[model samples]
Target: MPASAPLPKSARRPRPATDYDVVIIGAGSAGLSAALVLGRCLRRVLVCDGGAPRNEPSPAVWGFFTRDGVQPSELLRLGLEQLAAYPSVEVCSLRATEITASDQCFTIVADTEASRTRSITARKVLLATGVEDELPPLDGMREFWGHGVLHCPYCHGWEVRDRALAVYGRGKGVTGLALLVSRWSKNVVVCTDGPGGLTNKARQRLQKQGIAVREEPIERLEGTEKQGLQHVLFKNGDKLVREALFVHPHQHQHTNLAEQLGCRLNSKGAVWTDKKQQTSVPGLYAAGDTTAGMQQAILAAAEGSLAAIMINEKITKEECV
Candidate 1:
C-alpha cells in the first residue's frame, strides 16, 4: 500500500451541537480559572466576559503568588491563553443580559460588542461575576480610586506604608478596617465623616491602637495633578494632609444574575456558597469576590478550581447512570 487516506467528514460520526457542559459568566480570574479546570476535565465549557473587570482601574494585581504586581489585564490575558490550549473551552467577549433556568439546564442571553444577540444553553452555570464597590459620595473621591484611594489594606498598604494614611468610611466596620490599616502605617487617622455610632468601647479600642478619630463630615478630597491625593477637607474648615486613604466601601453584585437566579446571599451581601462552591440552586455555582469577603486573585482562582472539580464530578456521576 502506498498511502492511507483520512476519513471524510460525512464518513465520520456526526458531531453534537455547540451545547456546553458549563457556561461561565465573567472572564476574570475566577471565571478563567474555572474554565481551565473544566476544559482539562474534557467538559465543554464556554466563558462569557463583559470586558469590564473590577480591577480594571488598578494598575496591578497584588498578593497573587508568582504573579504579584502583574497588571490585571495582562494576568487575565495569560489566563485566557492557557485556557485556549484546551480544545473543550471557548471564550467569548460578550455581556450576559439574562439567564433563565428550567429543569437541569440554563439559557443565557448575551449581547456582543457588534450589537448582535446570542443565546446558549448549558447543563450548569458558574457565576464568577464579581462585585461592584460602591464608593461613598464625596467630591473628588472618584478621581483617586485605585490610586490614592483604596479598599483593601493588604492590596495597597505596602505602597503607602509609613505614609500619612487616612481611613475614611462610615459604619462600625470602618473602625476595624482602620485598625487593620494601622498595621501598615503608624500615622493613621480615622475620619468617620459623621457621628459613626461607634461605641465608647470602640473609641477606646481605636485610641489604644494610636489611631486618631475625626468625626467631622468630609467636604471633599483635594488632590494635585502630579501628586494625587494631598488632603481630605472637612466641612468644618479642617483638613488632614494625608498621602493615601483607605475605605470600607459597600459592595454589591456587578450584575443582577445572582438575584435573578434566586441564589441565596449571605448577610454580607455575598453569594452564599457551600464548601464545594455550589450555590443554593443545584447545578449552579459561584466563586470570587461575589462570594467571599477576602477578595484576592489567588483565592478566587482556588474557589473557581474547587467549583470546577465539583461540577465535573456531578456531570460524571450523572453520565455514569
Candidate 2:
C-alpha cells in the first residue's frame, strides 16, 4: 500500500446540490399538511406537486371537521394560501420524477415542464404521492366519476340518500357495498355487469336484505347533467334507471418513485411504513393515501402532520439544523 494517488483528469466531480431539510413529493393534502408542520418547526422544506389531485373530480370534500362542503379545489387553494405564511416551506408546481437515496442525503430529479428539469437534495424525503383510481372501462363512467359515480358511501351517501342507487362490482365486494349503501337508499341494487359471482348463501342474504342483483353485461352508462347517472343499459336490451352509482374501484400508486427507491409494499399494494411512517429506507418516509390506511383528505393530512413531527424529532436527535 502506497500513498493515495491524485484523481484522473477524466474523473467527474459531484454535482452542485440545492439543499433542504426535507423534500416532499406531491403537494396534495398529505404533502401540504406535512409541509405545514415541518415549516412551523422551522425546517426548510420543498413540496413538488404535479397538479391534478386524486380527488380533483370530487365536487366537495367532506368528513373534515370545520371544513365540510368545501370544494376540493377550494380546499387545496386555501391550504396553499395559508402555507405561504411559512417562509421555510416552498411549494412548486413541478412533478418529482426520480429519487436517489444515500446514507446522508436523498437526491431528487423533478420535471418542471416539458424538457425542463430541476435537481434537489434533502436530508429527508416524504412521499405523499397518492393512488389513482382504476375506474371501470365503461362508457360515461369517467365523465361522472367524482359526482355521479362515487366511491366512498360516507363521502357521498347523504347527497344521494333515499334515491335509487347502484353498486358496481362483483362477488362480496359489491354485496358488501350494496348492503352498506342500503342504509343510505332502500332502493339499492348490486350490478355485477356479467356474472353475479355470489355464493348461494350470499345471494340469500342479499335477498333477505331486499337488495337486487343484476348480472347482465352492461352496454354503457347513460348520464345527464341533471344527474350523474341516468341509467344502466344492459346488453340484453333491458335498462335499470338509477340516480347514482357507487364502486370500489381498483387503484394503483400515482407515482412509481417508491418502487424505484425499493420501498416495500404493503398487502394493499400501498407503500409499507412503520408506525412512525418511516419507510424501509432510512430518512425516507410516506403518509396519506400512499400508505396502507384508507384514503381520505383529512386522514392524509393528519398522517402528513405525524410524519413531519417524527422527521423533526429524528433531526433533533441527530443535532437539528
The local distance difference test score of each candidate is: 0.89, 0.90
Candidate 2 yields a Cα-based lDDT of 0.90
lDDT of 2 at 35: 95
Could you give me the TM-score of model 1 versus the true structure? 0.92
Across residues 40-138, which tens digit of lDDT does each residue of candidate 2 receive? 999999999888899988989988878998998898899999999999999988888899987678999999867699888999999999999899999
Q: What TM-score, over all chains together, does every model reach? A: 0.92, 0.92
User: Alpha carbon lDDT of residue 253, candidate 2?
Assistant: 95
CA displacement after TM-score superposition, residue 268 of candidate 1 (Å): 3.1
| Best prediction by lDDT | 2
Pairs that clash in candidate 2: none
Clashing pairs for predicted structure model 1, backbone only: none
Off by over 4 Å in 1: 1-18
